[model samples]
Target: MDVEKVFCMNGGLGENSYTQNSYLQKKGSDMVKHITLKSLEEAYVSTTPESLGIADLGCSSGQNTLSTIREMVEAIDKTTYKFSNITPPEYRVYLNDLPTNDFNAVFKILPDFYKELNTERHLWSQKLKSSIYIAGYPGTFYGRLFPDKCLHFIYSSYSLHWLSRIPPGLYDKEGHSINKGSFYISKSSSLQVSKAYLDQFQEDFSLFLQSRSKELQSGGRMVLILLGRRDRTHVDRGNSFLWELLSRSFATLVSKGEVEQEKVDEYDAHFYAPSKNELEHEVKKEGSFEMERFEMFEIEHYSGPYMSHGTAVARTIRAIQESMISQHFGEEILDNLFENYGNLIDEEMGIEEIKPTSFISVLKKL
Candidate 1:
């Protein structure tokens, strides 16, 4: 599959859209907001650029996208006034994502976004001394996305875990998949399967650091938040269990003849949840940035007042995974698939807790 052309969250403002189902992601972003603001302040004070260039990589469409950017801008604005007693710099903001992402959804809300931003600025002072120019950049973050030494502060939340592509070598000498029964690494997967996933993450993350290193100006700061595992084991009680449940859902479909077993065997998820040690090793190996801060936080999955725990979790996963799954398995079975997924989740909730952990890292270009 062409990942750039096929990968994206479910779009629009419908019930299943990412816009509505991203509360968990929003919570994760809030958990790291202080780190992001602190990093932005340091980047601003160090470089003191007249025009602050900021980029949000993997910036999918929704309120979370602009809300996070607004917070960063506001933080810098306050920092500039406190230190220099002068107007903040003009803002050049780049919002980036895959080519197939719903740029239209983000663009549609810009008028309201700009209006709100202008109103907020007016409240601070009568004069609007600084301007923010926002533009959408469509591409993958695994390679170069900006001009050399241009960006000042970079931010990405809950997005780096997505691999640029499914890891190679999942198949054997005769081209049969080694991870046949699972879409992701699980307790049942062989050591070779775990190694392949980790190898892919190291390659992709190294390239990410290399590309951003070239684009960021000297003394620039980058704050990254991504899903991570707490232990050295390939399987975790959180994300891995979710995938296992989905795998069971697929098995149910296959048995009932609603989906094909061969297609299930051939498919693999283009994602990885790295351990903290793995992240530290890659940062040291890349040799371009200094790690200023590293933190890990966990968010529990719970039932909302209006929905069951299973339903809430199912919608969240569907909003993120439906696009890729639909492309591979056909869209017809999505409803039944997720129904089974939700039921399986409900069955498991009584047995164990579900809490996904995430990592927040602050890196400064040397």
Candidate 2:
């Protein structure tokens, strides 16, 4: 399935990073620091490649993507001493994502990127020696995004679980009562939703491996930073928490006649949160790559009270709201909903609870 279709119904929440350029860039920079330092250390132990290149899968239109590129270039420059005998090889980068993603927005940021690089050159004589040229390509990483044996490093975050589309047999009736707010284990939730999501992830990830196995030169490395569950074998585990919260909110909306019950019922996210074991199993299944590191850690995110809502609006609340207020609920409704949701979260989790995000399962393709 086309990648865009998988993200078709996604609420604008993920896109919020496009507007908060600094936070997103900082995130990418941190990721680069972690991955690059590790990759360099690993290369020192094993056969080190003469050249290094990277691809950021799901590089959406935002500062995070640009920050990642900048960090990569800087790290490479600092690490050049490690390859003292050999000249730093040229870097070829491919930035990939869904076709609907705003590639032009990323392009708009490049001029500034060059300006920064030029500035860095003036500050550090070493920067003048590194030869790095970047190119951006918008496409689905579910398939090949580059020529055979072309990549040395690949990274993806918050992108792997989206199925190509909603499953065919699933649909909510017109009244929105039946399918309203059904998750993998809710009112309309069934094993089918969970299984379908998992099946698609496996299929898509398998294809991703097949593509990477051919694209990555021997000893190339790839890192997938995703939201992963702790237990893969837990039978009751699924998107149950999300379902519980969303269903309750929708049920409230239905009682108040704010939205059709059926409309809520019809909506289902075609996403899966794989457990670490599940992700590891899938990677081994392809028999193309070896795990270098597998770690799970959480990060804190401040959503001002909106994200706690767990309703439709929570999915799109940004760090800053500019003018897209119309696509979400009216300002008044959003305010009330967030107030209620915030109180509920405070009651349940206390005032200090932070949103948890999972880190990466770093892999090296041999």
**Winning candidate number (lDDT):** 1
lDDT of candidate 2? 0.59
Which 10-residue span in candidate 1 carries the lowest summed lDDT? 78-87
The sequence of per-residue lDDT tens digits that candidate 2 reaches over residues 1-366 is 233533422213254334442342245337546865577445423544556667888776666777667766666666664566655556667888777666777787788887887688548755345556667776777787788877777877666755555444354344232333564445445655556567777787788888988988778777777655666432322234533554565467668877665555555555566777777787889998998887776544434443443322243322222122223334444454444444444443453443334657678876
Candidate 2 clash pair list: 175-262, 176-261, 176-262, 176-263, 177-261, 177-262, 179-265, 180-264, 180-265, 181-264
TM-score for each model: 0.97, 0.78
Which stretches in model 1 have alpha-carbon errors above 4 Å? Answer: none
**Predicted structure 1, TM vs. truth:** 0.97
Cα lDDT, model 1, residue 235: 82
User: After superposing candidate 2, which stretches have Cα over 4 Å from the reference?
Assistant: 1-17, 21-33, 40-51, 168-180, 184-188, 233-240, 301-347, 351-357
